[model samples]
Target: MAELQDELTATAEMGELAELSSPTEEPPAPPAPPAGDALTRARALLTTHPVADGYCGLPATLRTLPWYDLELGDSSVDTDIPRLRDGGVSALLWTLRLLPGTAHAENPVTAVLEQLDLAKHVVAEYPEGLRLARSASEACDARAYGRIAVLMGPAPAAAIGDSLATLRALHTLGLRVLTLSGASWATEAGLTRFGEEVVREMNRLGVLADLTGASARTARRVLAVTKAPVILTHSGAHALNSHPDNVPDDLLVDLAAAGGVCLVPCSAERTGSALGDVADHLDHVRRVAGPESVGLCGAYDTGAVHPDGLADVSRYPYLIAELVERGWPESDLAQLTWGNVQRVLRETEFAARAAALRRPPSTARIERLDT
Candidate 1:
């Protein structure tokens, strides 16, 4: 991997970009469009910006769960945001959860820290991403509404010396969320006293401890030691799917009690098949953790051939509509769509962590708030 400076050292050409579009930045009005035809209006100007002007083509400029498949390059630096913004994804979380034994062309920590420039750029170029980044809003903005973030990893903390520094660096980048353990088990937090120091540091830094692919013991010990809210970011229900990767109901409840959530998805790790059976795990977490702390996220575009009814990112509105058809309250559906994540991102206390690092923030605060 190449050494990347913290600053978003863009070539001079990129420096001339205009401020992001705002309500005041709209084109002069013409005739009004119909209710469902709003997307047509949005699609008309999807390519307004040069970088985004001719990007991903779809029926309309739309948002989805931002995808995370970055290769180390100049394009990698800023490629995701424009597509994510154009895709209608309000919040973008890069799924750079490194697989085990995948050699890095560069240092992994550098990869994450380099993103700070990216975060700044996203905010600058797409203020909507900044609002989505800051407020974690669910309400759609005409241009954009999503925070651009990176998944902390499938990496174990032991992989990086002074892993606390990585957590601190990520938090500084406004990376408020991270997974507990990833698929490959190289140097994960799981190895270090069940990641006690890592979890403690993550909690202190206001980072989330995701328990997506962890063992029961790893999950429990992490829950026990971590002061930050822990989450099962995405998984199947062990109660139903019974896959090792699926989280057991008991742990699910513990995560909920800790003020965290369980993200159920249609991925094979959770659902065994690519059925995109979001509801199976959603309902499962609902039973285990209750309605408030349960939610959904699909690891789509893996070419993993989705089961019928759930093929692409565009299918999300259908998922929400499904939740509604099941007699679920709109409030709960909102939580599933965006509220729970919003709570996690906004309510998390990174300022204290940063403050503590400057001097010392109370670790006890993490315990108090986490429980």
Candidate 2:
């Protein structure tokens, strides 16, 4: 019995020794941090499809502060180079408008020319950060080069006076958009004969007609007359908000059917001052107009209040993050951020080519046509 017990103890000791002699196994690696957070995902999506903000009143803001440099971030304004870059903004259609009560409102054409010059000067001044894009393709190229494309235009056809030659000249000066306000015509009756001719001429010039402030009748008339797809640069869904700047459901339908884009703005006046409110406007537009017909505009630097989460250009990702939390598919968000506007620009260019082939520049003057 004593010998058997000794042999058993020896065997147990041998097993323990063998176990200790074996190589130690590595501890399992710590689990990686979660990458599915809404903000993180939103940032990832933006890296591929950066925001192509349809309307930014930065030019007007810059016009006021001639000595201000955009590179040095300004606390007074919502847009700056740093903020725009942080927001993943790839392109901006900088609106050039001489407000009715402003200093140079009398000679709108010259004032508009000065505004255009300022826009060009800024683009040239910040060659490393901004590139003046005359077309959609140039905007894309600017993105590839890691620069923001600056597209400039003056609002209201009145800025060009009553001459089609001025309109053509503006296009040559890199005016990619021209807003057709109801005030441009001599009368309030929808669009006069001259207005229709202006629309056609704009179609030929490849300038996007913006109907943001146009009356419903005028918007519809422009829609019917324009050969190219128009854009409401900084508008919202009127069904959601009762603001005059918002587009009605019927107009939304017509705009979408015409292959135009309605860029939902993040202004408190047009959309409620909350991230969710802006998202709601986006959802409403997408629901009513289809995803392909919807886009985004910060409407920054316009002296209007902004939503809580979208207070400035840098807040775009947060709004995108909110949409992400709401189960918005990345594909749809891509369209909202960039694809829709790019498509509209491409289609507008195509229409312009077709229009040029169909007819030469109209010699119709407002005097003769309206009489």
Candidate 3:
């Protein structure tokens, strides 16, 4: 019995020595909590690469409520200073007029000028929140200053009334985008002779031709004639929605080849009322037109209902988070949100400079050219 007890004591001592010789190990790290969720990653990504929204109809809405204080946030509107900041939107191209064919103003030019004035006044009133950006560099500068860059225009081309000089005047008044609209320009036969001249002058002036509601023929003609990249500021993939305003795949390919961007809108009429529906359109655009050719626009304050997850400006990160969940790389998302639009604006400026050196301002009149 004593021998057995001695043996047991020896065994206990051996076990103690083995325990002392063994290295202690930490418990598994609980999987590190995934580093962050998709939404967190999306917000972080947007900090470096903020969204350059292609369209916002705040100006048009402001025209009606001239006294509306944007600083105090408006529940009636989808856009406001607080919401814009929350959205991580660094830049916006504010439409200065109603959609084409909808404005029944006796003088469309005068109406557009009124909207432009209102937009400038609003920007000036909220200097801390907004900065008027005339170029891509200016927009980036605004972002650096922690301000939202507001770019105005693409008022109906008809607003200029077939006068290239009027177009120049509008540019002088801060018109960076000129909508190619009206019955004569966007028909099946394509741009009239005057329309081509207007596009040429726009190229020389550094104005982007906005093909928001243009027909395929007009889009093709502009692609063929303009030396600068164009933008479909608020559109979707027709293949997905079949809306007349949605761009078809063939045009998207042509637009991509021309170094243009198709800014996908969150309009439920075109993309449905679901967040996945908007993402689907975005994916379709990216697939058909390539990554560099896709962009985002909330189309807020435009009298159109937005998708479920993207009902207002503040929901942009949610869309980005959805894309992140779909395995989109950071680089591609960067281009989609910011880089592509900035590149388009930069290229448009470059094309204008080159065009200016080659030709004088066009004096071509609609009466003389079209008739």
Candidate 4:
């Protein structure tokens, strides 16, 4: 655990923060706030608003999947709930995937269905602590009642198979977000025609299409066709890290122009540093594509190596403090944390509801396909 703290604190030149204690340490404490008079107010302001990790995971959800194999201990079931509550995280987009090449990879559609069932089961087991959020209003309500709103998303293009109706059915079953493809799907190129159809279906169904794992071509194609705002739920800027998973400056500008948000993640795979690196990615996205275009998608508890100060879900305040100390305005911080994501959700859901009302009653048909 001390080794993890050392890795998190090994910043480039931003000095270091106090060591973050392991989750099992006595009292299960949150990270200490950076020294300053304004930090107290920053922490207060953070708790005042409904804080949302645009993309995160709970220990229970990850533990159910053997592939993760995380040694979360008792914290997996008991302690992490309080950790999130104490950290002021009211809502999160919980990702559930059955990636290709895995044991459950036979039928992508069946895999997604089973995974969705598992997600519901986990949420049901924790009735008081968690609730499924289908719309932005539901997420805010979860915040008002002091419960964590768990919005579910399926990753990559394979999950939907070859049918558009399958996409609609998943949304009907409470899947709110969709990823057209990830980095691995990059080899399957020339998807302009089919990709456009999928994006349109997502708009009609009111699902937010996430482009985190998409190739540049796929991302650009979807952006060109999507009428509603899209979200790069967990990615970084290519200008900063040059990873294929990261979005380039051209796509970043395109994303902002189309009323989308590029949510920056704190994982080492995305950003090579900790809190300071996160701030840099956030600032770069804002600078390249305005403040409204950036947001947070820290994939907590998904088995990714988190940077130092942000080693767990309970350390969100430290990230907020780092941004505040860097002179981010309160309004910008609000947008980064929750406002932008809420706006996208509300708009997307509203459009979906409206489309459903205008459609003919007989149009709802399940197109049969062999998956």
Which model scores highest in TM-score?
Answer: 3
- How well is each residue in 1-371 modelled by candidate 2, as lDDT tens digits? 99999999999999998777767845569897575688999999999999999888887788777477678788867888899999989999888767668777777788888888988888888888899998899999999999999888636677778888888888888898888884546234688888888889989889998988888888888888888898999899888889988999989999989998999998989999788999999999998999999999988887778888888899888999989988889999999999999998898899899999998987877788777
lDDT of 1 by residue, 222-323 (tens): 767765566665576888887666777777778888888776765554565533356666766776788878766555433233445654444444455455
List residue ranges in candidate 1 displaced over 4 A. 1-89, 99-102, 105-107, 110-159, 182-194, 272-276, 301-305, 350-371
> RMSD in Å for candidate 1, one decimal?
19.5
Give all TM-scores, in the order shown.
0.61, 0.89, 0.91, 0.80
TM-score of 2: 0.89
Please report, as a residue range, the 10-residue window in candidate 2 with the lowest summed lDDT: 181-190
Q: Write the per-residue lDDT of candidate 3 for residues 1-371, one digit (tens) a residue.
A: 99999999999999998877777944456755464498898899999999999989888777666467678898878899898888889999998765446554657888888888888888999999999999999999999999999998668776787688989999999999988976465566789888888889999999999998887788889999999999999889999898988999999999999999999999999888899999999999999999999999989999988888888999999999999999999999999999999999999999999999999999888789877
Off by over 4 Å in 3: 1-36, 99-104
TM-score of candidate 1 on Cα atoms, chains taken together: 0.61
Best by lDDT: 3
> What's the lDDT for all of these models?
0.50, 0.87, 0.89, 0.74
Candidate 4 C-alpha lDDT tens digits along 47-160:
876467876655335546454312233354322566677567788887766544676666767777877887787677777888888899999898888788888874556777
Backbone clashes in candidate 2 total 0
Model 3: what TM-score? Answer: 0.91
